[model samples]
Target chain A: MSRINDVGGMEGFGAVPVDNAEQPAFAADWEARVFALNSALLRRGVYNLDEFRDAVERMPPAEYLDASYYERWFAAITTLLDERGVLPRADLDG
Target chain B: MSADHGDGALAARVRRAETLLEERGVVDGAELDAILDRYLATGSPANGARVVARAWTDAGFRDRLLADANAAVTELGFRAGGLQPTLLRAVANTAEVHNVVVCTLCSCYPIALLGPSPSWYKSEAYRSRVVRDPRSVLAEFGLTLPDTVRVEVWDASAETRYLVVPRRPDGTDHLDDDKLAALVTRNGLIGTAAV
Candidate 1:
């Protein structure tokens, strides 16, 4: 089954946005935090890189599309933690 | 739901996850800060540019880079892999060929060299079209290649990341490594534009 993330060669998504303006490494503080959290979790062996990628790919299509790049990373980190029993699933709900 | 609405909810969830992890003694705030700092310090487009500059000046280094990019990059004290080990392949752009790198599945770029990928690189339009119709996609990026110049689009779907060594522009023979490196941009290293 091809996931939404496997979006190579399927068209209809218009022109790529090419704003040459200076783009920051992280758009927001939350984004940096999310990136750091993901890195830390992976380094700690909480979940492997493949598992984290699979969690991102397993997200509901709508949620995955609606979330920003770092938001997707944030979602994957939460999902992995819940699945690994590091944090209860209810913790993500609230 | 739009990304704007999702951002608020996701931010709260991230904060909750961080707090939970900290409380459980799984991850520390300082450790996370250090990870971010390490990337911030080492990850830059300049690193990739320096590699390209070395290739432009030293033919031996260029041959080594094209033959084994992972080992070649290590000579400059740069880590090609982050978190986990990944293979790095250097594809040189010659007079006959032009190369571009893309991650069709996800944004799997060489972050240690080129910093984080630009927003357009991760967009659906680029990932889906670049692989199938590179000429048109390169045109969108304002890079119009000649018909004779064959375009090669490398899909970084797996662990191997690709770095494009753009051809050195003419009249740069007298320039030092720093000056030559300054001419190389992240887009040039990605083969989206000429240096």
Candidate 2:
């Protein structure tokens, strides 16, 4: 079940890009805050790092591939909170 | 390619989550923002570059860094505590062998040393393929090694982080610390590119 996140040595992954020098530390303000939010939540013991990573692992492969980096974090964290019944759909649907 | 300003829906959802966390008294908005801002300011690849430059110039420091990377970083003012993971390991690339870093499960990296990881590092392509065929992956980064040289791929995890210390390039023997640090790119520190 957790094997989904262990992506090493899998085949069919294409060419690696050459634009590593171009990216900023983060793309947008919200993106940085989202990362910070994960850190904050981890520090506050809302969930452990392993559980957070497990949430990400359980995301659909297609959605995981298409979303931006922090977008995935947002999705995964929201999924985790909702699953735990800590945050309802109404809270995030706004 | 067109720019990505980030997803609006995701941002809105994150905002709502922030509000909820505040309402639940899990974290205060202002306090969290301040901590993130501090990390954003001090955590960068430049910190790693400086560490490499010092190692290149000072033999004693190099010994200390290679022996205990986590503590060595503190000597350069990058203190680790209070949620900062302590198991950072520094690897060196010599003429006979090279090192590359990847996180197969997630993009677990030494953020304080390398700044936030580049998006590609977190991409499924790089994460999955790098460890399998590091030479080819390095080639894509415009680095090709001789057949005689060996490649070692380090998989970073939540418990342990890795930093690459590349062999200093020739013709820089006369350079000062700042000048040498300038030549150490973020990719060099990640072992995808030579300094």
Candidate 3:
């Protein structure tokens, strides 16, 4: 099945924003933390890059579209951890 | 449904996940901090620009970069992928051809070289339209190519990434390495604009 992340040729999105000033590497502290966490997890063998990508791709279409870039990475990291039994879904809620 | 960086719930969830991983011995906060520091120190557009500058000055390096990007980049102390070995392909922009890179499925870019991708690069409008109507998309970025210049859009995958080797601008014969590298921009390396 074609996933929402597979948005190659499909259109309807508005104009791409072009800003001359370079954007900071991370928008916020949380975003940076998410990036670091994802990298650390991947390096530690908690999950491979493809597996994390699959988790991101498996997100619901609306959810995937709604989430920001690092938010999606956070979602995939949580999903992989939950699936791997490293962190149960309930634990995150609690 | 859009989750912004200010979303408290999302931030809380990320923190919770980090704690859980630490408790489970999967990863620690110190290690994660170290990784972030490493990226902050080395990841930048300057790295990619330096590679482009060297390629422009040294024809041998240019040939090696086009032939085997991964190994060639290593010679300059730059690695393509993070945490995994990703094949890097250098697509050169010539007088007759313009090359652009995109990951339709996800934002699979050479982050180590180009720093973080620009927000527009990961936008739905770019990922979906660039492959279909590159000229129109390039026009949106204010890069209007001639009709005779064939555009090639490269779709990056999980195991592979692409970097655009922009053509050297004229009248830069006397510039040193640093000066030439300074002339290259992030957009130029991404093929969204000329250097």
Q: Whole-model Cα lDDT per candidate?
A: 0.88, 0.82, 0.88
Clashing pairs in 2: none
Candidate 2 runs further than 4 Å off:
B1-6, B80-84
What range of 10 consecutive residues in model 2 chain B has the weakest lDDT sum?
Answer: B1-10
Please, what are the lDDT tens digits per residue for candidate 1 over residues B50-78?
99999999999999999999999988888
Clashing residue pairs found in predicted model 1: none
Error of 2 at B99 (Å): 0.8
TM-score list, all predictions:
0.96, 0.90, 0.95
Interface RMSD of each: 1.5, 2.6, 1.4
Q: After superposition, which runs of candidate 3 have C-alpha atoms over 4 Å from their true positions? A: B1-6
Better of 1 and 2 by TM-score: 1
Residue-wise C-alpha lDDT for candidate 3, range A4-94, written one tens digit per residue: 9999999797777777588988887889899999888887788888898889999998888988888888889888888988888888989
Return the lDDT, model 1, position A16: 85
The candidates, ranked best first by TM-score, are: 1, 3, 2
lDDT at A15, model 2? 78
Q: Against the true structure, whose DockQ is highest?
A: 3
Answer with 2 or 3, whichever has the higher lDDT: 3
DockQ of each: 0.74, 0.60, 0.75
